[model samples]
Target chain A: MSITPFNIPIVPKLKKETIYSLARKGSRIDKRKLDQFREIKITLGAAGKAHGSALVELGHTKVLAGVKIEPGRPFSDMPDQGVLNVSAEFLPIASSEFEPGPPDENAIEVARVVDRALRESQAIDLGKLAIIPGEKVWVVWVDINVLDHDGNLFDASMLAAMAALLDAKIPQHEILEDGSVRIIGPPIEPLPVKKRVVSVTIGALGNVFLVDPSLEEEAVLDTRIMFSFDEEGNLVGMQKTGAGWLDWDKVAIAFNIARNKYTVPLRALQGAFKS
Target chain B: MSGKKPPFPLLKDGKRHDGRGPMDLRPIQMKVGILHNADGSAWVKMGRTEVIAAAYGPREPPMKAMILPDRAVIRFRYHMAPFSTDERKSPAPSRREIELSKVIREALEATILTHLFPRTVIDVFAEVIQADGGTRTAAITAASLALADAGIPMKGLIAGVAVGKVEGQLVLDIDQVEDEYGEADMPVAAIVGLRKIVLLQLNGVLKPDEFLKALSMAWEGLKRIYELERSVLGSKYKGV
Candidate 1:
């Protein structure tokens, strides 16, 4: 990719004194505190012409998510649950490494992480999605498009996905035994959502962790961890990505930081949908 | 090709299916610079179909095997969004899309002044956000508009129009249903200079007379589209 050639070179092992000196001061490069999140901006209905869409900018990283609802049969095994299908596409221009084809591992991993966050948290009320109990139901297709790859795409994609779902509304329907469908116009009530789930990803670099790492940080970082929490602040899913090993102690610290950071966005998401 | 009759009628009430005259085109609307970071970009909406084309780079030539010394390499990507169709598509490029990209690349390459940027590459990405009939024509028109928006030197804008045979009548700008069930579909790409045909693709069946009639109908339509393209470019350059 063209961007990597322009990235800051990897540093050799740092001198012990410099590491200790930075560790003592409890500050990191880019002047960020350990747990403080970068600025967040959410633009709703970006593709206003789309059924439901949102663009999330977590600092420099950008993700666009769109939701489309259609009627289809639920999986036979999961007849009672609504289907949530998630897919992610990393635009070739988004980064130098992204190629044009079926999504690579990173894209797949991001999609899986977002799917887990949503499903494990029961963010959507599935029972309400059942139209014919065993015959048909509404399947929500949520697609995350990574237009810019700075870092922490998992969190940004999840954030955009959640916003898109909230913005989505399925029209009421009445199914006929002949296997045909009829649109019942607008719903008289709200679409059922069991919970509002949100996710945040944190990256660890050189023993110093940052929330919402920039593209540069993503390149330099050793490992990234993502956390999904519901409105009640209960941890729904946790995923560890990237390479290199991390001490369990640092993972614990990340968990603590995520707990504190999770509620802030949850409140914002709730307010975003109400309006 | 499926041998199944198309659901829409060709002509109704002495008018076309969409209620336009045989020579009239669907509504055409376009906007320039929809992609923020692109060097040049445009969005074209023809009837129900919407296409967005983004142009990037005059960057160094790709290091891979292919390179042309006299002309800059033009790489074209034509893709349809998953939700563009009534059915959900797996996020993978299908064979049809690859074929479309190849044809569009050749069509644009015929007129673009690639010699202006030697040892470099120019990328044109065309994404169909919605699909009706005439998607390829809309893509070509939007791509040319985007190239103009990028300020890239060109001989002149390229305008694309499709003429189809429906119920023994020649029709201009065939919609999706028409293209499917219509007896003959002939899509042509014409440039402003000599009004020459740079791109031509035809499918289904048509007699020689029908082909000639459709081509003439498209040529006439091209004259009107040329005026619109000229005015679009004129308005933009007027500000400069």
Candidate 2:
């Protein structure tokens, strides 16, 4: 499909060679530790119209997430639970290669990965969102828009979505005598969130595994593996992407590095709420 | 789909719901060059799940803009027939299908020597005729065989499987029942010859140690599938 990424050229040979050579030397182009991540900063309430919103910047990459909660029909299978819809748009404005249109595989991948993290962790207690059992429940929508493309959009978008979900408030509503809901002006109750989760992406180049790659570093990456963890250190989700392969041992190493460094983003999420 | 768990335990004594042990895999069957007019094709059946994969091209790309200077572009799509499931699924591609297509492509790309055929497109389409569970893994196994049948140069073959937790037990080659009721499911694909994992995804909750156990089990499962794939290819070549 045109929505999928195709025909994209690999990074320039010279740059790829330089990165590979540096990796062979156990050094990086940006001089950060192999396991180090770029600086991360998150801003909550970036969108006023949204029930919850966050803007996240990781190095030069920027992502905005907004949450809108509305009373609506629930899925047939999950009649008592709320519906969580996470979508992402990779606007052309973010990068020259990112065309404006429907969401592509990359965007879908991001949204699905983010969605899995939240759902698996039981971050939101969906059963609590029921307005009328099996008929009506709250629908929580998370729309993530990429403003700039640098690298590690996965981590940035998840961070933004989590922060937004945490900051979200549900509108007041009540059931009438006939099970119809009465309208309410503004939201007051916090979403029934029970856990905090963040994902870590580790990009590999031969023997060297780099955490939270930059745009330049990402172009030459052989493969990348990501893991999501809850605040209590429970492993929630895992995904491996890119064209390269990794041995099982290397995956273990990546997992350990992720387990240790995940606190970086979790702390950033907590710090956002404190201030 | 009903989220209600079946009243019976998924596993009793040492037998799973299907009468297999926890480590037992559903029976597998495969055939190569099954479809006409395709450069290469394969049909694979694992348990009740059935999938067919076809590979075409390494020829000129349909769009001039799609030609790359370095390596051939690989386009992949994983689809399920409307009647593949108990319920009639929409023919339109869902987000899950889209994601699976991308992930399966990335996994197969690791084996293809794309640089050998530049400025072209290598197309692979995997269609599921039945959906039992682990269709993506079955599709990967079938696609790899189709590519091999097409005579594409490759570093190695790929085999895929999923290990999941059901009833607090770590089970190999999860089926639809286990997948639906299980607490966690992780699908994995590997280039067993290279001892490298090319594709992996985890959904549901898995502790760290459990993750390692499930991965090791998946690797073991892949090894068996790889052997089956190799023998099938060898038999096909012999018949020709």
The regions of model 2 sitting more than 4 angstroms off are: A1-10, A24-26, B1-4
Question: What interface RMSD does candidate 2 have?
Answer: 2.5
Itemize residue pairs with steric clashes in candidate 1: A1-A96, A150-A215
Give the CA lDDT, 0 to 100, for residue A103 in model 1: 72
True contacts kept of 2: 0.63
> What does candidate 1's lDDT look like per residue over B100-164, in tens digits?
66566766765678888876788888899998878888888888889888887777787888887
* DockQ for each numbered candidate: 0.01, 0.62
Clashes per candidate (backbone, < 3 Å): 2, 1
Candidate 2's TM-score: 0.97
How well is each residue in A193-230 modelled by candidate 2, as lDDT tens digits?
99999999999888888899988998889888889999
Scanning candidate 1 chain B in windows of ten residues, the lowest lDDT window is: B203-212
